[model samples]
Target: MRRKSVVDTLREIRLLSELDDGEIAVVEKNCRWKTYGASEQIIDQHSDSNDIFFVVSGRVRVVNYSLLGREITFDDLEPGGHFGELAAIDGLPRSASVMALEEARIASLPSDQFQRMILSHPKIALKLMKHLAYLVRTSTLRIMDLSTLGANNRVHADLLSLARKVTKDDMTAVIQPIPVHSDVASRVSTTRETVARVMSDLARKGIVERQKDALVVKDLERLEDMVEDVRGE
Candidate 1:
């Protein structure tokens, strides 16, 4: 077993807020570390998996590759995320392909050991179940947005999704810009130029303020107005 630092491993497990020191040791003792370069495939969808992974740093995109072999990214995993739990727990094939978006470090636990740990520690299983449920609900909402909303409204809903994650205050949500317009377009289901034009318009309207790393929501009410209009149409 290639052991990683326990302290460093714990830092990536913020999603497991209910797990305390004693429980954490069980987790750290089981982990192995690996590094991946940008664009590396971590796991192929439908492939057998005997390892569970926790992101130590950098980003991974969870995507679906269709029969036609096109990749559709559903979510991006940044720091403080854990995946591969589902396949480990259920002994099933991977549900999605994971690809590193940047150079990343990850902690891995053997699937057999993970299953044993979960049975021994009810809290671990409970916390993991809650986390998985939240992902399902969030994904359903994203699919709902794409189905019913206009591109503008989908953008608004997605921004709100980001807002809800940023802070409880809701007034100061940070939506970062993509250096590439095509990236933004994929998220909002619009053209690259359309996302650029609409984002510029929102900035001019004073509903969004651009800062170094984010587009801050200065006025959520004004932003929701755009969503409401889409629902009306």
Candidate 2:
């Protein structure tokens, strides 16, 4: 890709979205671009790497493996998203492994350069702080779900969190790109068979409808109530 195009892509990232062309040019100059094939490892958990990664194209998943070798997915990031900021900010080892879900393009900036960018740009630093805060909250919520909720409830919560809000005539919402059962299982720390069973039960009860590309919550209120019921139990 052309240098100008690379700069433009960097500008589109939320962390750098507000940067002026001159600032973006500076970032573009410091970044190193790399591509990975499908299912390739981008970063290993606990590895010492001070560079932060920004996804330019395609998808990647943040994951960790259990002692027994089970894979737990933390998040799926697409273009305009980023990872490794935690390590970059604190100079620690990676908290989780990153893998390309498909062919992907990434831009990496060394920790020192990233720190300089943040120090020179207060707004960017504030954005990074806020993003880190959000990640912390998400992690806390996941821990709570795992500790207090059953596998079935965890599945419900996971799907609800992934769903997009929409209003059709009234205010109805649906989750597009309904995740595969195996993916849901990984996120919820359950077996795929359990996810499939819970999904089937929800479908039979008319709480949710599974379509080709999406999952429609026929009764949003009921679904929410179900989640609450699980939480209270």
Candidate 3:
């Protein structure tokens, strides 16, 4: 694609939408595009590469390995999502690995360029700070969940988080492209068998139903209640 098309694509990204046309043009001229196949590692944990990556197509996962070699998934990101900003901003090694969950296209900006953009653009800097604060808040919550919540509650919380509200009149929601049991287990720091059992119990309780492509949440309020009950315990 031409440079202008690339600029337009970048403009669509929420983080970059605030940039003026001249700034966007500069980014378009400086950024490099790269593609990775499914299961390919885009960035390794503790690596020193300080380039920020923006997902332009497909999906990627942020993962980290425990000392015992267990893999934990932090998040799944899709188009318009970006990662590696933390390292790029802080000048630290990557805290986790990033892998392409499917064939993916990414736009890469060198650390120097990213820093320059943030320094020159007050809105961009503000957005970056907000994004980092969000990451910190999310990490704190995850730590709390891991330390205090039971396995079942963790699974419930994970499912509820993955669900998106589907209707205005009712509490119906859906997790389209519902993740596999093993992936959910990884996220919740549990085994697949436990996740499967908890999911089965939820189904039996009529809280959620499994469909071919998604897990339909019958009552989002009930799911929220479940999490609150666990918190109260």
Candidate 4:
């Protein structure tokens, strides 16, 4: 595979989308790029490195371990997504550890450069604020689900959220690279066994089917209704 040039990789980053070619050239000069193998640690939770990172290719998961060493996943970021800005903004340690879910290419801008960019670029600043707002909102929802919903319903919400991200049609959706039950369990704070059972039940009900490389949601409406019924929506 051809290694992407600095400009090419910068072009793939959503956070830098608003930059003009000249602006990107400036950024290109200031940023550092690296690639990691699958499962490689990109950033350690509570570490002091404050460079903001952007995904140029592949995927990464933001996560933290509980006191008992149980992993709690915060989110996954694919190509075009960015992370680590919170640390840059607040001048604090990383809030979560980040690991590459697959072999991934990433770009990093030093905290000082990132802060300067935000101060100089109003659009970038606005985008950052909006993205942070979204993070807070989703975190609130997750907290609510954990506090009020049962394990099964939390699983439902997790699947529903995933399904919405890659909906195929009005009646169907396909989650490519079918989710790992253990990962779902971690995300929803349920046991792996519970996630397996819930998924098996979903399969038996014909609401979801496992394909060669994906999980197909056969009855998207029905699944939505199931989630809504519990949420009283």
- Determine which window of 10 residues in candidate 2 has minimal summed lDDT: 163-172
Off by over 4 Å in 3: 1-8, 165-170
Report the C-alpha lDDT of model 3 over 60-154, residue by residue, as the tens digit: 99999999988899888978789999888889889999999998888899999999988988898998889889889988988999999999999
C-alpha local distance difference test of each model: 0.74, 0.85, 0.86, 0.90
lDDT of 2 by residue, 153-193 (tens): 99988776665345353334677777799999999999999
TM-score per candidate, in order? 0.77, 0.90, 0.90, 0.93
CA RMSD for every model?
Answer: 4.3, 2.7, 2.7, 1.8
Residue 182's lDDT in candidate 4: 84
Ranking by TM-score: 4, 3, 2, 1
Give me candidate 3's TM-score against the actual structure.
Answer: 0.90
Q: After superposition, how far is residue 13 of candidate 2 from its true place, in Å?
A: 0.8
Best-matching candidate per lDDT: 4
Best by TM-score: 4
Q: What is the lDDT of residue 194 in candidate 2?
A: 95
- Model 2 residue 1 CA deviation (Å) reads 14
* Clashes per candidate (backbone, < 3 Å): 0, 0, 0, 0
What ranking of all candidate models by lDDT puts the best one first? 4, 3, 2, 1
Question: Candidate 2, which segments miss by more than 4 Å at Cα?
Answer: 1-8, 165-172
